[model samples]
Target: MIKITYKMKSYRENLKDIIQPDDTIIELGCHVGKSSQFMLNRIPNGNLIALDNSPEAKSKMDKLSFEYKNLSFLNSDVRLHESLKKVKEKIDKCDILSVDLGGGYHPDTTFKVYYIWSSTFKPRDSIIRNRGLIDFINTATSNEDMHSENGFLDSCGDMGIPPQIKEFKLWSEKI
Candidate 1:
């Protein structure tokens, strides 16, 4: 298992650039609140909604919540459409949607969950695990005809993501 310190270091080095002070952030798969805590430190005036299905994850975040008043934990399976809908209704808009569902989830399921949760918010930056899903989405959304034979690109194309969505990398390196 990857230690939480490594995850926190990865976020600090690679993903910290995208976050702003007052941005409303929603993190999917807050395992042990490690990543959430990293994001919390940056968002002083901002609020975070951390979601995870594991009871242990919830318990860990519950303990950390006392230290950070702006952080909130929601114990729910982010892959579920109902849970995504409920979360979308609660937040007016999300500035950043950080997704790290861990290695248990297949890349396709991760992309599907990201797509579902992303639709609720208007054009915002996102940091996703560099599990080929980001590369696939970037290639699919761009007009450049690269990686045509890639399986992930084919899958995103099948999902009907238009070529108009802007493509950018939020993290410099994979965590």
Candidate 2:
């Protein structure tokens, strides 16, 4: 399951569909450990490696780490290649990858980050929440009448295709 959305109403909504009990998860941008804690609660036999650059976020997650043996916090910026290498060295496998960079208002950066991390870990499942991505889709598909009749698009539903879908499909296969 790969979910790319404007925003998740709640991160926990579809967690069961993406994770298993013994799955190893790598979560990027786990701010204050709210969703981190939620994922931790769901994975008792598994482990969660959460990365965030914010010291305050790490401070909070440190407390959760103390309480949940399966949870570990890494203080590293996800946008840096060095950080990716650091994470790669620590984990042998990543079963699921969850990313929510907060204030995701830049589609190019979001897509680049998502692509790098997804390609690196090659997680079986990935969930990314970025408003800019949805905005980009809307703008690119506007002239094609891709918007819904209600004038709103739901990322989870069938929101029509972008002009580049044909080329994207072909390019994706090479990977």
Candidate 3:
């Protein structure tokens, strides 16, 4: 099965740059730890906590955790503030917080109504949505292009998402 997720680009503030070896990294929707591995490289001595509430996802995380001594897995929902707060205490400030809420979205929201789910095309068989959420502070609009065959880009970016977030991107100045 193909997935349609928020796309994230590595930047200055990204885990690879900002997170020191001693710094702890927190990532949401870690899934199978695809990008998690990238962040791990930046922190040699640090521990990475991948947050995902799904049992299958968590089990996947468990499998990955054994490989990396510096890696830890957590099975908890995003809305579970109690658990998240506990994590926050250990890691005071986040050098990078990956907001990737892709898996387990119940297929689609109101936006999916407009999305073409099924047709002469075979949906995921025909197309795959590769998106990674990025940081867009104090913004009301952003621009992005949909897939080649698909130009209809209904981005959540407009609802306060970043245009492009990659390779050491940073915004210390208050919006």
Q: Which candidate comes out best when scored by TM-score?
A: 2
lDDT of 3 by residue, 74-145 (tens): 787644434455565555444334445552334332123212211101221111222211112222365854
lDDT by candidate, in order shown: 0.65, 0.71, 0.46
Whole-structure CA lDDT of model 1: 0.65
Error of 1 at 155 (Å): 14
Off by over 4 Å in 3: 1-17, 103-175
The lowest-lDDT stretch of 10 consecutive residues in candidate 3 is 117-126
- What TM-score would candidate 3 get against the native? 0.50
TM-score for candidate 2, please give it. 0.75
- Identify the runs in model 2 with alpha carbons over 4 angstroms from their true place: 139-175
Clashing pairs in 1: none
RMSD of each: 9.9, 8.5, 14.0
Flag the better candidate by lDDT, 2 or 3.
2
Worst window of 10 by summed lDDT in candidate 2: 147-156
Tens digits of per-residue lDDT for model 1, 1-175: 0111124456555557777899888888888988798899999999899999987897799988889999888888886545666676687578777777873424676666565555555325666664455445555655676542321233344333332332321111111
